[model samples]
Target: MLIILTMVLFALALSTIVMFISSLLSKKTIIDREKSSPFECGFDPKGSARLPFSLRFFLIAIIFLIFDVEITLLLPLVVVTKLTFIKTWVITGTFFLLILLAGLYHEWNQGALDWSS
Candidate 1:
């Protein structure tokens, strides 16, 4: 129990010191106008909350989020491939890719991917 407590205290102190040093090194004293603004999506953070938003943008964001989540799921397959049978891994990876491709194709067909309109 004493050893465990000592190790925990050491870990806590080490983590706190590392965090403090990293924060000090990376601290941004000057805030730039572009940096302060919201990301590429043009809606101003301080603007009217009731302003109408583009549905096309919303759909694009949803699709991006769906694919982002799928990517996260797919990343684990690289690690799992070592533990699972080669045939099983291949089948799963192929099926997942096919589903992703089909969804992308459907969205493209629906004109959700078209920004020019």
Candidate 2:
């Protein structure tokens, strides 16, 4: 009981010291307008929210997110292969890849992927 109590006290003291040191170190000695201003989601927080946003840029962002999610979803298949049969793994992976490719092709055909108009 005494050893545990001593350990708990030591941990609390150590953490408090570390936190104090970090707080002291992280303080900004000099403040600037650009550094102080809040920036959010590729847009200036100080700018008018009603400003026109590009539809093409939004579409490209959506496409990037879709492909990023596809990569995350496909990565689990590598780990799952050891847990499942080879035939089942291959079929599922191939089907998923084909679906992703089809969506990409459709987007390309629709000119959503084109940079120059």
* Candidate maximizing lDDT: 2
Candidate 1, residues 1-117, lDDT tens digits: the string is 999999999999999999999988884755666577776468777677788889988998999999999999899888888787688887999899999999999999999999878
Global Cα lDDT for candidate 2? 0.91
If scored against the real structure, what TM-score would every candidate get? 0.58, 0.67
Worst 10 residues of 1 by lDDT: 27-36
Clashing pairs in 1: none
Candidate 1's TM-score: 0.58
- Stretches of model 1 off by over 4 angstroms after superposition: 1-41, 44-47
lDDT of each prediction vs. the true structure? 0.89, 0.91
